[model samples]
Target chain A: MADFSLFSRRFDVKRVPGFASVALGVFVMLYMPVILLVVYSFNKGTNLAFWEGFSLRWYVQAYHNEAVQEAAFRSLYLALIAATLATTAATMAALATTRTKKFRGQMLIYTLINQPLMVPEIVTAVALLIFFAMIKVATGHTGMIYLIVAHTAFCIPFAYLPIRARLESMDLTLETAAADLYASPWMTFRRVTLPLMWPGIVAGLMLAFVVSLDDVVITEFVKSAGQETLPTFMLGQLRRVVTPEVNAISTVLMAVSVIFVAMFFVLTGRKN
Target chain B: MIEIRNITKVFGAGEHAVTALQEINVNIAENEFFTLLGPSGCGKTTLLRLIAGFEHPSTGSMLLAGEDISLLPPNKRPVNTVFQNYALFPHMTVAGNIAFGLEMLGRPKAEVAETVDRMLRLVRMEELKNRQTSEISGGQQQRVALARALAPQPKVLLLDEPLSALDLKLRKEMQIELKRLQSETGITFVFVTHDQEEALTMSDRIAVMNAGRIHQIGSPRQIYDHPENRFVANFIGDSNFLNAKLGNIKDDQAELEFAAGRKVTVPLHRADLSDGEVSVLIRPEHVSIAEPTGNSHELTGVIENIVYFGTDTHYHLKLASGEAFMARLQNNPSEAEKRAAGDKVAVLMDAKAIQILRD
Candidate 1:
């Protein structure tokens, strides 16, 4: 009937000139390397730079390699422990920050809880490396606990954000209603708050798990001599040899992180 | 029964302090439906929160059935509230929500189930017992909230504008339902609402509040028929305020001289009555258009506007003194001849219906 559009078609982000090509350019810039890596992972040739015929040779080799198996197991174990610990601490922090009435220094508390996310990853890695180095020299013990603790600390903010959002969206009066019905604080949290924020918690847990699983910087710096996670092992392997087996391990890791991230978005995007 | 003695609530501290309620003293009798009636931000909800144990008074104490409950937490108090937004737990079924309070009180499984069944029957929500609270309509959620609050069998039930979220028809229905539940359960109800009609219709006694003070406290009829001051009179209903000159005061009556030299005798309810310069309040329904042969007691005014409300018609009039007045007349076939706008009419006020209000 009538054109009531506020801006001309040229101003529309999707309809602007070269929008599709620019979008394609961005996609290629972001994903072309990963796509090439994945493509070469199926190559029958030993070189990662050239793809010969299609084959699952590297996938089979990655599956059978003892170093790959051990690093994969270590990555999964570290992610499980770190994600669980981070989610627990994040849930408590989210509740403390969202449930109580506004007090002095609340903004400061928020910034402190999210310190890792705000600071550069390299800075955190160096800080943790130096801090843990002293403890290693003092106790003469260097175990996976250092890596788990570092990863958990880094994942706290990732887990905290989604849970805090969920807590803030929740109706405060529901908790009041629970208390009005003679429910103690613990009972109210268990019966009302916990059940309602379960989706956000699950989303946060998945996000933290994915974050811990794919982390390379902190793991590289904090890990001991022999305790190489999957990512660190792949990094060492790349220095020694240019092979598609590392590409295969990377594709598997990418697949896992994508699945978990998809699930995270689904959970957090839920209306209720 | 609950007693609030010299209760005052002040929010914040030092320079930012705000007095929400000041020197409030009210004693609610057992099983009586007492209402805290006021506009929003007038501290009505604050008073209700104090009584529900959600907030402790900044000063003074509260007693529930002769026991001091001033320091008790909300969970420790034997009271429940139906929040304004219903606040139904979205994760729980209706029956589960209704049964939660009992389970928390350490009631036996059989008793909790029986109580939940009874409450569901009480609120007529049996069909939606298994449904999640998020799936229910607003009215149904309101009922579930009521049932959940009442299932605890508290000594008193506090409702903080619980019907405000429902549509008009549902609000009316729930008003009647709330009144019925109050009487049937024999528990005291403390309801808070800004709607004057709802307060007048359901309250056994109403405490009209304003600016952190209780202006008046009485039965509905007493508050409506004999409001103590200007705020209560203006807040409860429509009124025509006229400047009158007080002549003489008897034991409980006074003579008021209005415009057009119309003098009428009115009952004096307040002890602050003076000899000159007073305001007189007359309800629209109490004033009528006088016939052509009206005498000295009639006031001369021109009809400014006529608003027809199906059941009744309100005639807006401008008096000879340039003051505005309204007269409501019921629409009946056998009534007097209809007066149009710009028509001159003699206004006759019932002497006893005129109320003397303090400034």
Candidate 2:
């Protein structure tokens, strides 16, 4: 039997106030670091060992740097291409795995798709370097194509989780009913299934883009001279000098990542 | 017209094989609102899915309006189904949902708009055309589902418990609406439900199914007035069983001697009994509380319990032979006028009310 009460049966002002204090305490503990980071990105300090007063010089300096600007653009371009490719592949994988019954060795194929995420990034970097070397020997080509390929492989698993989650959570009865209503497979997918999954697909694509934007290991191994991504360029700059400009760029990247994650929640989160 | 012949569906294979339907044969006439009524796991839904082409029969073929459609996919078939959940597109507006089937058929934009408007007005939802599906109530969604299914004007419309999601009052209203819609459209509406009252009220003909097979198929009155088997009789309505043994056999009537020294006459077929044991089934409403019977069926007993309903009262009677039977009184009576619990009484029943079940 159920009490079926909309409110709590036991009402106590003292207990309610005590619970509110505990919840507020948890919030401060979790968000204090993020509150500190944004406040100090504008600090006028040469060294990130401590934050000084706020100034516009670091922001101005970061904008004027040629190498940093070029690498940032390169990273943006690579992340865009890699995210598109990876999200497309992951979307297809999610559909085939969830909508259709298992084909031969489906488990093996799934494991292989998710392998780059599980295996050490260093191993993946080394493997891609070798594989690219073999391809170069056979066809004789040298380009940033290898770096893009490596980043896409690493981002696919991250992209796949959200799409697969969305697909599994979806009620497939609508799709079957759509089919019975004379919508072909392609039309049913476009009209009924895709609209329902748009939120998940966007989340997955953004996740893959952010992962590619932050990647360092694979790009370091695969890039030739003058082809370093933003992350690899940051690694080079950090080796020479650790400046507030690095903090400025890191702050910007972290902000972008936060924005994407926030958008993900807004798009996919249920009201309840 | 739809024809299903030797339709057998088996799931799994080898050692894991399970047969879900067994050589089902049925011919559903055009424009007939048929119902497949049974309990859960009775394969009624499976039969509907097979007709909708959601499932392929493992053994036999099906024909729709003289064309062999057995190998056709669901989208290619001339049928649409309103799923148990209604299956309304959650992302689309009501108008968009209804227009989906027409759009899929490559209809012109003008014609699709005209048809969708006609259907919206038909279901009386034209004002709510722009509303999201989540904003509407269940009964409204039921109408939307019906409008969507009928907008395409498929040869047959399949409804899998379309009204099961609503409360009792709404369910009754939707039942009447569904009947009217079917009659006006003149398309085959094959409904599947377990509720007997719903099946009896709306269906033109009812097929009583059990355990993956149809028990009987007849008009609603035929099914309610005369059920073919003991299971059908028990499933359809409330009936009281009186233990009896066969006394003698005659043409078109059999003599049954009840255990409590009462004899009842019933229609006799060769399958009625030769017999070792048998039972007589009479609906509770048909049994009378008064005792003016002569040679039809008469019994003396004590009223163990009295249940006074608004329209009728039920008397639970216990015989001297330790058998309990029930009789219904058409009118309500005061406690002082009615026989109290544990009071002795006599009851009578018509011979036409008795059905003999052979064992």
Scored by lDDT, the top model is 1
Q: How many clashes show up per model?
A: 0, 0
Reference-based lDDT, each prediction: 0.92, 0.85
Off by more than 4 A, model 2:
A1-40, A44-53, A102-111, A126-141, A270-272, B269-276, B290-297, B334-337
User: Looking at model 1 chain A, which ten-residue stretch has the lowest summed lDDT?
Assistant: A4-13
Q: List clashing residue pairs in candidate 1.
A: none
- Per-residue error for B319 in candidate 2, Å, reads 3.6
* Predictions' DockQ, in order: 0.83, 0.68
Model 1 chain B worst lDDT window (10 residues): B290-299
lDDT of 1 by residue, A1-272 (tens): 77857546547688778999999999999999999999999999997787689999899999999999999999999999999999999999999999888989999999999999889999999999999999999999998899989999999999999999999999998888888888899999899999999999999999999999999999999999989899999989978887899889999999999999999999999886
Residues B3-26 of candidate 1: C-alpha lDDT, one tens digit per residue: 999999999999999999999999
Model 2, residue pairs in steric clash: none
TM-scores, in order shown? 0.94, 0.90
